[model samples]
Target: MSSVWAKKVNSSKSGFILSTRASLSRASIVGGALGFPRIRLPTKYLGMPLYKGPKKSFLWDDLTSRIAARMEGGEAKVLSPGGRITILKSILTSMPLYLLHVIVPPKSVMCRIERLFNKFLWSAKGQRRIHWECWEDLCYPVEEGVLGMRRLQDLVNAARMEGGGGS
Candidate 1:
């Protein structure tokens, strides 16, 4: 395979090495003439992290931290409820939309995001307030006496369904 690829490249580069997560035997290593480099199990490719199996908490650590950092920027605290909602809809939710399109975030992660939005909506200091309505009711259309705030889980589920193509 390497020989075929080398033929295609036809380059005189001497430092060519094979980097893979596969386990190769000693004889195969000698036959391939490829140098193996130690690599971590999961690595980033094209900005998306690559792993061997299902998504896990560790895989989401960077994304979670990014969301936390954004929330901690103090922008949410200064805005009024309406302005906070606007920012939530336009900036905060959109931050993770691309990732949601690719992977269904865990419930805990979604809950943390929702908590941040909830705090911004109800209180200026990020504290919990007396609820006038349930989250489901709050997410309803404005005509229905609600704020029309789209739920993150619903969006994630919709994206998953869309990607699955009616299956």
Candidate 2:
């Protein structure tokens, strides 16, 4: 069965890796017979890391760096609250939505992102000012007398629910 599948797929051209527990090292035997190179565990597939076990903070380091890079700038300081909100909703939040839909990030990562948002919204430089309301209150619907900012966890929940996770 495996031989037949291997014969059907030209693995070298396809960039497919044969991942197995057995230590099959000889390329002449494994590659010729299986038509693929042996790969180590935790290979990346379609930009997301593919590995065994629960999601970890290291997996999200690149994404967090990207979010932090976007949040840092003189432009963020200059923008009004509404403009900052626009960037948060349209640019910053959307950056991680694709990953969030697939895996739930750790609490520390979420907190870091939230802190970046809060700082951009309230502070201009090293100086800090009192936030008029907590982040949760600010994330409420506009009709509730707050900015209609969607929380990252809430967005992940919604995505999970839509993907049939909710009963």
Candidate 3:
């Protein structure tokens, strides 16, 4: 029965020879991408082919290495609070939220605008925005008619604390 089946397949006018080669090529192309290099089965073995040897997994290894390298480059750098404050001010002034809306209207942009407005309250220019109210007043909780901005004075005091208070 096996001999008859093989004879029928090989003797077909449909050109099984070309089709088999095409199938092998397609399988190899897909298997190579999946890190399984193609291996030629011995003609004597009708079934149950063995895994010949190590199929170089360089494609998979190289892709993973590139992703790891990129993550390392984007690591955040530490900066002084004062430096952060200056950078925030520059971003706000250079590209106000309203102006940014024309270029890239996004929810994050609106959030940033809100944050900058809050920062203005902590800035030296904050005093000029309103009279008879210190920067702390504007930062007070909504119940106090302020937006609950964190107190810069407290942060400064904490920074100057002896032995980094409350370790």
RMSD of each: 7.2, 6.4, 23.0
In TM-score terms, which candidate is top? 2
lDDT tens readout by residue for model 3, 1-167: 35544433322222111233558667766655554444453211222222223422331233233333332232202333354344434533333323222222233333333444444434342132333454345445668765444433333334455243111
Total backbone clashes of candidate 1, pairs 3 or more residues apart or in separate chains: 0
For every model shown, what is its TM-score relative to the native structure? Answer: 0.65, 0.73, 0.20
What are the lDDT figures for the candidates, one per model?
A: 0.65, 0.72, 0.36
Question: Model 3 — which ten-residue stretch has the worst lDDT?
Answer: 42-51
Comparing 2 and 3 by lDDT, which wins? 2
Reference-based lDDT, residue 152, model 3 = 32
Q: Report the lDDT tens digits of candidate 2 across residue range 1-167.
A: 35544446667544435446545555447667666665655666565666666766676677878888877776766777678789987898788888778877787778778777777677655457787776767788899888887778888889878542211
Best candidate, lDDT: 2
lDDT of 1 by residue, 18-132 (tens): 3464446643664356443333547654445666666555766777677667766776667777787787778877887887887676677777777766655676666667756
lDDT of 1: 0.65
Error of 2 at 83 (Å): 1.5
Model 2 residue 25 CA deviation (Å) reads 3.1
Higher-ranked by lDDT: 1 or 2:
2
Candidate 2 residue 135 Cα shift, in angstroms, is 1.9
